[model samples]
Target: MEFNFADRMSDLKGSAIREIFKVIAQPDIISFAGGVPSPDTYPVDALNEISQRLLVGNAAAYLNYGVTNGYPPLIEILKERLTKQGVVKDSDEMMITTGGQQGIDLAAKSILNKGDGLVCENPSFIGALNSFRTYEAELFGVTLQNDGLDVDEFKKTIKENKNIKIAYIIPTFQNPGGVTTSLEKRKKILEICKANGIIIIEDNPYGELRFKGEDVPTIKSLDTDGDTVIYVGSLSKVLSPGMRIGFVVANSKIIGKMEILKQVNDVHTNQFAQALAYEWLKNYDFEEHLEKARLLYKHKCELMLKTMDETFPEFVTYTRPEGGLFILCTINKEGIDSAEVVKACIDKKVAFVPGFTFMVDMTKTSNMFRLNYSTMSDEKIVEGIKILAGVLKTL
Candidate 1:
């Protein structure tokens, strides 16, 4: 029998990160391929205790169906947290989704029509790019500088391209590149978007992981009109990915539409998980736990960078992220494809994702690649860096 799939399936490819995970699952392999939290930092004990309490005392509420918008207590708590940061004022402005990825998908679905334009960083998050692609969005890539998105180029792109619906950004501690946008740039980008009537989709899954610098205000926080920015956040980086709890903060009108759309998607997010997340937030000392995680990531990042400095060729350069799970390595040697480097590293039982996979056009080659340091130990990081340096040297 022949099967017909939707046209959207034609260009959608499997996640490069997940594909790499298969090869690196071997115990002997030292993988810097996944942007995952360290197992050592998971609050297993706290969650276990929370789970028992929920089962014993709150099983009726937790095990039953939840509202499409999410668990109410969780919503109130999250709203208060974001309010303190000046992102959103009212609880109705938010909707809890399964994770940040779903929030991205919902935001794109709500605003984008087929062939609408979406301006994004050149090397943006693959998941977000793919989500927009599902809606047949025409992606316009703007250069991403060390400080953040290039405001001048962004303005030029918007002026040249018609019908650009939104500007999708991961302003703070961006994935793959791990670069944070400066406060001045953030304001400028917001101004540009507002001037052009383009919505700003702010995906910030890693902001809470900052270990070095002071926290920059979110683009949503900067929205004086309150309707221009849709902020997406997750507990994946701070809490547990398996629990799958994330939320979207937007204007009430936008959030109401998303809530309706969500009803047709999954009916609602998991009830048990939402209950557990709410309980965890209410009871646990999350700040202390966050500090510990930040220190751990900081130490690992330092170790990785120090090793690369000593081992990698002088021609090679990498980003110095204040905080995030990744570092983008640009090998200056001409004709060196990062894909080849990844393949060779796998043979040596070490892994890092090639940069091209994150690009809007995967066929385009780059001498760049991304490495993650959060999941590996000090010794494993040293070993992986040594192996990767040898691979780069040979190329």
Candidate 2:
């Protein structure tokens, strides 16, 4: 007998990035498709020490059921850290999530309903987009300029659709595009959302991973009244993704509802992971750890950029990111499908994600693709670029 699924599951497709990742699992494949942090950067020894200490000394805290709002010490630490970063306020509250992805999912679930309008950058994070899609929200794509979301287009989009519930942004070193929204644009986005009463969901997993540029103030920081912003930060990039520890900063009222949602979702994020992360933070030099991760990613980004310059065709253009795991490449060839190129690259033992995965309209995004530089070694990056360059020539 066949089992029927929920109607919402009908329109929801599996993440294209994850699908490509499965295809590139062969040992020969050099994958530029995964948005994963380097395993070499993980603080394994520190985490091991932290885990052992927590279990030996604080077993009750580790093994028992935790508060739905999260492990309080972790939440408190996040509040302190994010307050310094300009996201959390003295008046604001925080909620710990299983990971950054859960923050997105909970935000969508708490705020959105079917056919509710949501504005996101034209090519946004696939996971966040998929999370919003699960709620059957009608998405409006705002064009992303070099500086940020196009203000003129955004104003028009808001004007045309007045019922927008959320405006989601990955302001710093955005996924796939690798474009940071400018400070001026950040303020303007906040103003637009404020005027329209639209909630701004700022996903900032990569903000602390900056290796080459000045830190920009988060849009959430600019919210003096806590009227319009919900900020999500992650330890996935900076500390350890496997720990699955992340936090959300929002008004206490919103966070109250989210805490209930969190309870139902995973009965609170992993207590052992939270305790371990807290122990790691307490025992290690986190700033130094972050700096090391930054340096590693910076070198990888530089290597990929240099390889692209030497090997890719003149018509292929890509972003030069200040930080983060990804760079967007636009192929100049008309009618050349990136999905087909990705399949060809897989055959050649190199893998990258097609751009359509990030776009609301997949049919119109054939000329683009996203490359991630954070998960591979310098040699793997070079080899992957060479293999992809060969594939592009054939295309």
Best by lDDT: 1
Error of 1 at 257 (Å): 0.9
lDDT of 2 by residue, 142-252 (tens): 987667789889889998997789999999999879999999999999998898899999999999888897888999998887569988989998877878888899989
> For residues 1-395, what per-residue lDDT tens digits would candidate 1 score against the true structure?
88898987788998898899899889999999988799998889988999998899968988889899999999999988989989885533889998999999998999999999999998999999999989999999888889898989999999999889899999988888899999999999999999889999999999989999889999988887647899999999888888889999998888998988899999899999998889889999888989999999999999999999999989999999999799998999878889988998899999889988888787788888999999998999999999899888887
Give the Cα lDDT of each candidate.
0.91, 0.87
TM-score for each model: 0.98, 0.97
What's the distance in Å from true for residue 263, model 1? 0.5
Cα lDDT of candidate 1 equals 0.91
Over 4 Å off, model 2: 363-365
Q: What ranges in model 1 sit over 4 Å off?
A: 90-92
Worst ten in a row by lDDT for model 2: 359-368
Q: Cα deviation of 107 in candidate 1 (Å)?
A: 0.7
